[model samples]
Target: MPDEPAPITEHLGELRKRIFWILATLLVFSAIAFSFAEQIFLFLLEPVIAVMEDRGSKLQAISPTETFFTYLKAALLAGFMASLPVTFWHLWAFVSPGLYSQERRAVIPFVFASSLLFAGGAVFGYTQVFPLVFEFLSGFDTSGLIEQSWTMSLAFSTTARLFLAFGVAFELPVLIFFLAATGIVSARKLWSGTPYAVLGIFVTAAILTPPDFVSQVLLAIPMLVLYLLGVGVAWIFDPERRRERIQARDEESPGEPGSDSEDHSE
Candidate 1:
């Protein structure tokens, strides 16, 4: 006999358990990250710090508690990123029951790709976008009248936020690929929404990158490319098409369904 499906209450309980483990993992990692938060932030901001030095500007701590809280924020961000593999695993574990065996086999690739894409985006922002945006901003020095005194809190927080934003934005392709594969979205719909997606992408890029056209375009272009790639992937893996193929094959099969009905009639 076939196994019975789990009830909604059982599903909810399973979800709660996964959420609990995810949160616990984050808390533990964040505590560990707190010990090395300063090192991590310094590493991430090394390039920007160099640009600021060139402009005779440096990150400053006016208030006593500002540095402490800044490190805390950095720790939290690091912990969230560090725990991504576990988070992805839990998410896959929850969803795999509803998927075909072949789909279930994709969990490893999904987790690896998601973590890599996020880190790659952050690296891109650090290597390419930050230097350009900061260099352009630092170029404007008010004709050397007032000295530039950037607050530590604002600088660290803003850069960290932008790093996370860039990382999240880079996951667009994987997200679309998953949704299209699962039949939640279709290639035709994504194609039709290209104009609006372009507008939204630019707007998002503007928000995520610094206030510079070049930086915004830098982010937007890659995202647009990824969006197009996702559409192509969606066309290939779309479950509806797979179902149609199965249906066509069934129609060509002469007696599979008829034999079942005839056996029932006897």
Candidate 2:
């Protein structure tokens, strides 16, 4: 028996339902995170806390409401991170109808890699970058002339921004892979553009990190390595495509007297 085609209206209805479900899943996670806001805040502030403890500095909240709102913000960020998989799956499913089997296969590795890379980047920022940044900022304080007090809102906001920035930066490889797969660019072109890519990564690092060379370098180095990794992965994964292109070029070449290529030699 032949399969029946879905109506446009039915497809639209299904899309709406999926969107609703994604939203519902996000909301559920958000509520759960909010319920555990204190723990989430502690988790987010772990690196800073450890650094502060080592230096005998206190992290203080200027206002009573600051702590409350900081926890709420932490919970929201946690919820967003937790719900990302559901959101991505819904998005993948929604657009899957437009892709062929090969395209779909290529997409699977990218999606999985992207999620893992993002999580790893976040962990890197939290464990390595955050402590270093906090230490650098804290070191600038004078004992008698100045007082060091970090606002809860400012601390949490900065942590969240850095975490998100690192996470997105780690997705560079996935972006490259998609560009290569879609023919917008090739692995060879990406490899050839290494200098420009390095410059761009440093620029992005300056923009995303605190106004310090150490933080900028920390972000830029990882991004540059990831870009190189992307080129290698694209080359290895698409070797068959490269071979086919080479074969096609050879077949189209005007070689011998009785070759398939029609000679318009001048």
Give per-residue CA lDDT, model 1, range 1-266, as digits (tens): 22258999999999999999999999999999999999977987786798888876788989999989988988988899899899989998988888777888899999999989999888888788777766776677767786877787877866786688678788998999999987799998999999999999999998886677877887898899989988998989988888889999988988755898889899
User: Residue-wise lDDT of candidate 2 within 140-198, one digit each (tens)?
Assistant: 86665776667668878878988998998998888887677666787888888999999
Tell me each candidate's RMSD, in Å, in order.
Answer: 4.7, 6.5
Per TM-score, the best of the predicted structures is 1
Q: Which candidate number maximizes lDDT?
A: 1
Residue pairs in collision within model 2: none
| Candidate 1 error regions (>4 Å) | 1-8, 209-214, 244-266
